[model samples]
Target: MARKKASPEDKIIDAALKLALAQGWRDLALADIAAEAKIGLPELAHIFHSKADILAAFERRIDAEVLAAAETEGIESESPRDRLFDVLMLRFDALGPRKPALKRIALDLAGDPMGALSLIRPALQSLGWMLEAAGIDSSGLRGAIRVRGLALVWAAAFRVWLNDGEDQARTMAELDKRLRQAEEWKDALSRLRTRKTDDAAA
Candidate 1:
């Protein structure tokens, strides 16, 4: 969908993303974004309190979109691995077309989350619900730990997907590795719980 630049807020966010893509965030300024959007600084400020505010808006906007898409992945395949594969593929499809800007947004996550926990914590809750719905054992798994693990999976898989240049073959290969690693991580976490239980008994 073409971004609507109808409102001052929309225009500013669009401009920031475009400028970030072209010249990097370091090269972007509130004035530059205002100029790109053909709005005045005062106008931009009226719509968004600050440049950081605009970035938070952009990050949050896409975060909601990607999270919804991740949730709506209708993959009832026999395995969670297959479901994960389908989810990752859907995100790639959605993000791949957006081109220049969304990819840059993905890269900026590490540097400027604005409220990473605010976004990701909810996503983790949703994913955990899905996992329980799928009959994945949640016993002994703390939501915070699960959330962090899931975030790592997302961040690592994103790095693999973003830089992949091999017609998606490499991307799928990377996804597969991540999937296997997830299983191993799950096992390790389960063992950690068991060892803690044994230490308590001892």
Candidate 2:
């Protein structure tokens, strides 16, 4: 199959990530990204209002890639936990190449609490898609709990992944352990809810 051409937004995202790798995310201006992308500042502004917007766009792109690949891979026959594991691993695979740039960005963002706060919504949005791709429900109350649980899991594993070697062995181990812990917590919560329901009925 012929490769699809990169869109203007994609070009801008690619340029921004590349610049982040070279100069660190904290130092790059919109104009720098525009120059790197070979697009004028006016054009860049039309596509993205700020660096956070570009980061969100990059995350959305990762979500799309993982969702598409998961659809192709299919995991309907697997257990729910297994399905989620596969989906998340696929996400890590998509993120693998950008690890260095992401590390730099993450380090820079560590000191910027407000900037980190801005990412929460987009991160949750991506995680919701990941849950959906795993054939899991990501709506309403239970869905909200699941999203938060997955967020913690992702956060813990992401820290390990940032420093993990190219083999990703440690990242996979950390992710698996965290997922199991989350599963236990989820099961306990479900049982607690069941007990409350029974008590109310009685």
Candidate 3:
């Protein structure tokens, strides 16, 4: 069977991820990534602006794959929480190949709040899409809160996931527990909102 060649952008992103994982994101350089990808400096520059951009591109690719998986898997029949679980599991599967890189990136950014800050926007975007993929609402003020909250939940699960061994049993357990807790909280908030609405009506 013939091997499918990666696109220019994929080649660049793959090279950058490998370099960042091998070293650290802070030490990654465009020239090195260009060399690793076997592309000229000018060509690499034409594709991405910086290491952060490359990381974001990689994340977007993962997000797209997760969304596609959600559709193909026909998760609409499941409950919202179950749908999200399935979608996220698909995301983890998509990221399976780069788990080591992700773990390294997390460790490198742990003490650097400012460095990790760049990911907040991208994380929010990813969560918003994840919510939508799970057939949940992801718009307006409520959507904003859901996105932020889910991002935190996912982040917590992701930390556990990084250390989880090949079975991923621990990661799945943590994610399920967290999602159940979130659902309980969501229910409580809904009840509170209903009471407030009744009070206002009275």
Candidate 4:
């Protein structure tokens, strides 16, 4: 069936997110949201009917925006070494408080990794693009090696972002450090491949 028009439920979601950003996720109520949204309780209930429904809508709303923003950014000043960081920059911007919907989605990721993986695909695809753009053609290399190398870099970046306890300054430093290490590994492998090619010719 064709989707119904936007309703007061959406307004309540927007209001809740605005309040959550203004305050924090820990405090928000249906009545407060209704007031903020300027919608009557019954009208909001007719669409959402419960707090959970509103929150779900809010998260979905956030996730879509974050993805769209990343899509718009595409990539920037990118190298194979720093592509993931650019992706992170775009995502973090989208994750700001005013975008409470995305905040909810992020909070949910800790408990729901399958969902998180779905959310993570854009970053992965961005990394893949970086690899291709940098002329690292997997088809020209050993398939297993290419896959494993990319997987390692991606996994390390994801883990650091998820669990690093350092302050933001140190964290960005670490991100840069990790990118350098990934580039170093790629360089080393290329040198080894060149040596092997010379050996084969000899």
Q: Highest TM-score: which candidate?
A: 2
Q: What are the TM-scores, per candidate, against the unseen true structure?
A: 0.66, 0.95, 0.93, 0.43
**CA lDDT of each prediction against the hidden true structure:** 0.66, 0.92, 0.88, 0.58
Residue 70, model 1: Cα distance from true site in angstroms: 5.4
Tens-digit lDDT track of model 3 for 86-135 = 88888888989999988888888897788788877878898899999988
lDDT of 2: 0.92
Give the alpha carbon lDDT tens digit for every residue of 34-136 in model 4.
Answer: 8898988777777776555665565455446655665666655546456556554444344444434544544545576564455344443444444443344
lDDT of 2 by residue, 10-51 (tens): 999999999999999887899999999999999999999999
Model 3 is weakest, by summed lDDT over 10 consecutive residues, at 69-78
In model 1, what is the error at residue 133, expressed in angstroms? 11
TM for candidate 4 is 0.43
Candidate 4's error at 71, in angstroms?
8.6
Q: After best superposition, candidate 2 residue 127: deviation in angstroms? A: 0.4
Q: Which ten residues in a row are the worst by lDDT in model 1?
A: 129-138
Candidate 2, residue 171: the lDDT equals: 88
After superposition, the stretches of candidate 2 with alpha carbons farther than 4 Å from their true spots are: 1-3
Model 3 RMSD in angstroms: 1.5
lDDT of 2 at 52: 95
From the highest lDDT down, the ranking of the candidates is 2, 3, 1, 4
Clashes of each: 0, 0, 0, 0
